[model samples]
Target: MKPNIYVVPRWSGTIHSDWYDWLAEQVEARWQVPLRRLEMPHWQTPRVEEALAFLSEQVPGLDEGTFFIGHSVGCQSILRFLHQKLTPESTSPNVGGLLFVAGWLEVDEPWDTVEPWLDRGTLDLRSVRERVLHKRVLISDNDPFTSDFARNKYLWETRLGADVTLYSGQRHFNQKTAPEVLSALREMVEPAN
Candidate 1:
């Protein structure tokens, strides 16, 4: 069976914004995979618990046939959801993969709104790393909001065991189309030997 693909959008982002729609189109057209573009609750002012709850309600199942592509804060939601849901006694199979675009461990500005997310203490990635079969992170060198590229890259690599890729001038990856993201998703779905 073709793996189910879920696209989680950025904070303050909609299903139609940026590359979400384009990626969904490409995934359905090329691979014929069932793709879901999640419309997060309170996207403009997202709270971690609410986001996770929304995911729990929206995602029916997770297993080896499940894949996720998350952008910005949506990345945090995905990781947190996995960390919360996947326990030692969990019976579900390992997830297929994850592709995080413009993901961040730290942010640059708008401290007030993001403070809650950042202050939630260290995210335990051990469960997530163990449960996920493959993990990849894509970030921009010049991302305005998530500018600490080196630190973010280090954390994603060391904590989540993700293959980190740095792009030039991608600026939080809010463009209309992201070939890099599409390419990475394809690789995760059909990895080359």
Candidate 2:
């Protein structure tokens, strides 16, 4: 059976399922798999725990074949959920692979209102690194959230053991027509399937 694909949206973004519909179509066409765009409650101003809890409930059977695509704070929430909620002995399933788009461990100034969710102390990168083997981190050179691209790149690549793909003019990758996003996710999920 083809693995299930889950696309997690960025915080405060009104994407819902539209952002990933194109990619889902591509995946369904190629591999006959299904894509689920997870919709969190209070997405406009999401809390870390709330998002994580929602994802946890949705993902009761996360095996090594399950795939994930997380953007911005959605990525942070996924990492936290994997690190805190799932462990070696836990019944919750581990993911097969993950795609992080414009994902960050921290956010910039004036956006600190969401800092409580981005707290570094609560997340564990080691667990994330150990859980998923195929990982891709996509960031834009001009992303407003990630000021230091080099540092963030090194963090995701070296720390999380993910392949970092740098893009230009893709601010937080919030566009409705994101071709690169579709391609990258396809590349990540096709091989594993």
Window of ten residues with lowest summed lDDT in model 2 = 12-21
How many residue pairs clash in all the candidates, one count each?
0, 0
RMSD of each: 1.4, 2.3
Model 2 lDDT per residue over 1-193, tens place: 5778788888765444446676777777877877777877798888776887888788877777788888888787778777775666666655788888898876666365577776565455776788786789899998997788888898887678999999988878876667787777767666654
Candidate 1, residues 31-130: lDDT per residue as tens digits? 8875799999999999988999999999889988789999988888898889877877788779999999999877877567787676234787788899
Off by over 4 Å in 1: 119-121
lDDT per model vs. reference: 0.87, 0.77
Residue 75's lDDT in candidate 1: 89
* Model 2 stretches astray by more than 4 angstroms: 15-18, 91-94, 110-112, 119-122
C-alpha lDDT of residue 150 in model 1:
89
Model 2 scores a TM of 0.88
